[model samples]
Target: MRLTYSARKRLGATSAGVVLTVIALVMLAPMAWMAFVSTKPDADIFSRTPLSAPEELTGGHYANLFDQFHFGTSITNSLVIAGATVVISLLLGGPAAYGFARYPWRGSGVALAFLIVARMVTPAALVVPMYTIMQNLGLLNSVTGVIVGVSVLNLPFVIWILKPFFEQVPKEVEEAAELDGLTPGWVFFRIVLPLALPGIMTAVLYSFLAGWTDLIFPMTFITDANVMPLTSSLLQMQTGYRIYWGELMAGGIVLTLPPVVLCFALQKYLLRGLRTGY
Candidate 1:
């Protein structure tokens, strides 16, 4: 019995939906388990029926995180460092991207290629050199060092992403702005930036994520508990003998919430920027 075209189309769409739903659930399973474990008592966390609903939800892990681990201070440090990194990346990368897209100076192509290569370099390979340099400069074990490190790592990516967006802007609009006696900087601020807002937001979001979730730089550069970010602070949950699963899970949830919330809030612009390449 052959189906009609409409019926076959509907069937195909339904199959696609099911497949996508399954994939989404697979990806989200670890996060869901982390959240569930965070709410369970230490005794109940290892039950045979691990996925079963807890008889009672407890905030003990969260309490221990704040009281014992000094997580509040870590949260503040992470926020400050990530915010600083985003500002630095945008300030430096935006103008560089505009120059790459709009200007045709000699060696411009080579410079852009160098930026791409810099982005490709592994963080681990640079960690030792960076540590040495920061130590020589007396910047190690401080929030400023972490901020500078993360910002440099994110800047190349920001430029690469934003350059395409700037290229999408029509040259005629900028020429008209110039005819109206607008300086290049003013034209960029007033016209080109507004036109590329979505891409800017996208770049900002990625830069924030890079800075927020970076563990290597923070772990290597920051030894002072007073200024550790959440990523490195999570390491404190482990000891020579055992790991604090409950507190670790709770901390993981706390760390995950910000980026998730931000992404959802900016879902519209992020999706648009990705689809349109701007």
Candidate 2:
């Protein structure tokens, strides 16, 4: 017997729910294991079943992160780098994207295409040249070097992400603002930008992640323990022979939390921006 439309809809919904639930479990399983291992004693990490509760738990690994490894320094450095990257990307990308959307001069599409292509290139491929450039500019072994490197790499992506959102803004709104005697600059700052907040938030999150999680530039350009970000610092947990699994897991948790928290806080804007920008 053929199912009614309502019955078919219910069946479809059930299937989607089941699929999504399974996918969520699959994705979350590794994170759960890492968190579990992080809290367990060194001896207990591999002893019982991987997911089983530990006989004892300790916060020593977390303590070691601060006491022995000075993980706090890494956290501070990463925040500075990420914050600077976000500011630079938005200040530069926001206006460029607006220009691209509103004023399509000759060869503008070609220029935008080049920007997207640049973003797609592997960071690994650019490392040698980037390193040489930073060294030439006396930015090596400093947080500023890493910040500059990350900003260069992330700028193209920010432009690409923000362009669509600017395009989505109604030209009519800008014209209306002009009729009310608002200058172009004031119209963008007061009217158009507010409407594009969702896109701006999305761009902010991406720019922040690019800086926070970048390892290549930091590792290549910075050697000072004080200047290293969390991504590069996490590698200190490994030596030639043995890995400090417990402390590594703890550090991983620390590194992961900021981005996750930011995403949760900005989830509404992210969803709205993605929906409307496309």
Candidate 3:
């Protein structure tokens, strides 16, 4: 059958819209379920019956999160560690990426290969050696220790991810800046950084997520409840006998928010970073 131009266009748009809607729902289902479960009572969590709503809608879980699990302190610790990890990784990795991007040297390729190998090194492999190092340095059970440890793990990835962006920058810009007598430091901070903002943003977000989602290092290195990150404290929510499902899910939902918000806020530039590393 012959279709009218407008009708065909409309049908195509509708089909695309439906496909995207389904994909979006699939992507978001876990988070939606988590939110739903957070409001549910302990009995409703594992029961066979369907939940139309919470057994009793209340803020009890969040209150319990704050009280019993010491979630407030853990959240604070996690934020501090993740924040420090982002800053440290960016500060250290930025220069390394710039060096790799600009100063290709005798062993630069091999050095980058080694860095990639390090990035692939599992946290499990490093845990024993790191724990020993932390012990010797007396860095165990400290947020600073976790930040430094996580940064060391994350920095190589940051540099590798960011180096391409720096390389993507036009060499003429650097040449012009140099000819204009701008110092290397000034050129990097002013010209290169501004152009490479998107990649830097992506690197920061990934570095933050790396630190935020990590449970292993924190679990192994941290001995004190006061120092446990949200990831480690999240495990505490699953106590054997009395699993307060609402509290557990509430904490999970809360912990999940920051990264989600960050991604949404930077999503446009994130795509650019993905494409051209710019």
Please report the candidate that would top lDDT against the real structure: 1
Candidate 3 regions with alpha-carbon error over 4 angstroms: 2-13, 273-278
lDDT accuracy of residue 150 in candidate 1: 84
Candidate 2 residues 1-278, lDDT tens each? 89999999999999999999999999988778778888999888867566667777899999999997789999999999999999998998998898888889999999988987888788888888878888898889898878877887898888878888888899999999999999878888999899998789899988898899999988888888888889988888998998999999999999998988887898886676566433
Q: Please, what are the lDDT tens digits per residue for candidate 1 over residues 1-278?
A: 99999999999999999999999999999899889999899889978988788899999999999999999999999999889989999999999999999986999999998988888789898888989999999999898888888888788888988998899999999999999999999999999999998889998888888889999999999988888999999999998998999999999999999998988998986676466532
TM-scores for every predicted model: 0.95, 0.91, 0.90
lDDT of 3 by residue, 1-278 (tens): 99999999999999999999999999999898888888776667777864576457667778889899999899889888888999999999998999999988999999988987888788888888989999999999998777877898898888878998899899999999999999988899999999998788889888888888888889999979889989998888777786667887898888899989887998885675566432
What lDDT does each candidate get? 0.91, 0.87, 0.86
Please report how far candidate 1 places residue 241 from its true position, in Å: 2.1
Order the candidates by TM-score, highest first.
1, 2, 3
The candidate that achieves the highest TM-score relative to the unseen native structure: 1
How high is the lDDT of residue 149 in model 3? 75
Q: Between the candidate structures 2 and 3, which one is better when assessed by TM-score?
A: 2
Order of candidate numbers by lDDT, starting with the best: 1, 2, 3
